[model samples]
Target: MTSLKLVIIFATLVAVSLAGVVRRDATDDDDDSGEEKHHGPAFLEGLDAATKDKFKAIFRDHSLKGDAKDAALLKLATSVLTPEKLAEFKTHQVEFKKKREQWKADYDAKYAKLSPNAKKAADEIKGLWEKDGMDRAAKKAKKEEILKSLTEAERKEVQDLFPHRGKKPSRN
Candidate 1:
């Protein structure tokens, strides 16, 4: 592969790894909501424990710095994302994006038809989310209240549209 391509790949992996680590650290509290934060391929869920441990070891190597770090990361990415696997992942991403857009459109259409009270509740929840300085639990509780305002069918439709809802999260 081209040197620039390798550099880009390495940089992207490092950034994702760093973000995951930081997010994990920030949320490592007793009050954490039982939610798994996943920001990568679904195949990552299929990796065996031994392979996952090897990947962790690569990131934990403190001696690797600068270009060495980049090189090591690139090597790791190359090994993990084989040509066939990468092709499948790219296809999956494209399909997922299309499905997400369709779901958003459906939700907008359904929401536009809600009764005045339900609409008002949804608006209040949106306002709460957009405002700064609100605690997560409070916001979530308020949002749930808004959902409760909806009819049973409407509530089920909304839950169905959300990819992360109504399904057990895979352990990282």
Candidate 2:
């Protein structure tokens, strides 16, 4: 009977020790996982208040809620721009405008040197080509809108070029 009591006591002690060890291990694992939950600093450091608000508004519209969204937008804004960056962009735009104007002047001077009949023909061709391009774009947009309103069969009946379904079929 004494031997049996001794065995039972020893088993109990072992089980208790194991349970304590298991609990300690679980606590340690919890701590390690908790470290990953730490949040970092915000990204909107240098922009003006108005711009930051605008950025936030855009972020909200894109369904980017919370600090993470704000941080991402602020980081992008900082990386791509500053007052200096804006100034640089404007300067490049001005330079490009000047270059385009110079090219146009040079082209006009060359056109003036051409024979009158040649210049007239060139102008006529340019006007006709521009008009054709504009007409094509307008027709394309109209066709797309019409197609959106159509059943597939009706769309298929519309000619690809002029999109006039009533026109006489062209001979290839």
Candidate 3:
């Protein structure tokens, strides 16, 4: 639909405008200025300046997504990543995956106890987030509508449990 295309276009524009400021460290330049530099993750901290820039560019690229993105990153890492660092990073990755799985399981347990209406609203909000071509305003409106359909107690519980609730998204 024309509206869907327009929404995607608008979202892209907003992203472009924010891109420069979103990542101060993603840029290739070495800043000698007094301002504090954004330190990369612990694993990447061991890499040299030029190597860091190369990896950063690969990571910043929008054209690479999903498996393609992972492959690109891995190829770059293969070149310069030390064996010890690779083992350390892999350990961290496994730990992260486990933590995420546990969190999802805990949330699912909580979700199972929710009222039918609450579950419906939660599903609608999750769908809004997952749906392609959904602009922020459209998602916000949809979420508000879903929340309004619930009773006061239901609304409070839903809002309290929401992943996005009470947090401003990170600019970095």
Per-residue accuracy of model 1 over 23-116 as CA lDDT, tens digit each: 8787676546554533345544455656556655765665564457646755665678767765655575577668767877877886777666
The list of candidate 3 runs beyond 4 A from truth reads 1-36, 46-76, 163-169
RMSD of each: 20.0, 24.0, 17.0
TM-score of each: 0.43, 0.30, 0.58
Candidates 2 and 3 compared by TM-score, better number? 3
In model 2, what is the error at residue 1, expressed in angstroms? 99
**Candidate 2, residues 67-102: lDDT per residue as tens digits?**
566456546555666767555534644665686567
- TM-score top scorer: 3
Q: Write the per-residue lDDT of candidate 3 for residues 33-95, one digit (tens) a residue.
A: 534454665667656788888878977876675568767777777777899777666675566
Estimate the TM-score for candidate 2: 0.30
Residue 115 displacement in candidate 2 (angstroms): 1.0
After the best TM-score superposition of candidate 1, give how far the Cα of residue 145 lies from its true spot, in angstroms: 4.5
List candidate 2 stretches off by more than 4 Å: 1-81, 132-172
The CA-based lDDT of model 3 is what?
A: 0.75
lDDT of each: 0.67, 0.54, 0.75
Q: Report the poorest 10 consecutive residues by lDDT, candidate 2.
A: 34-43
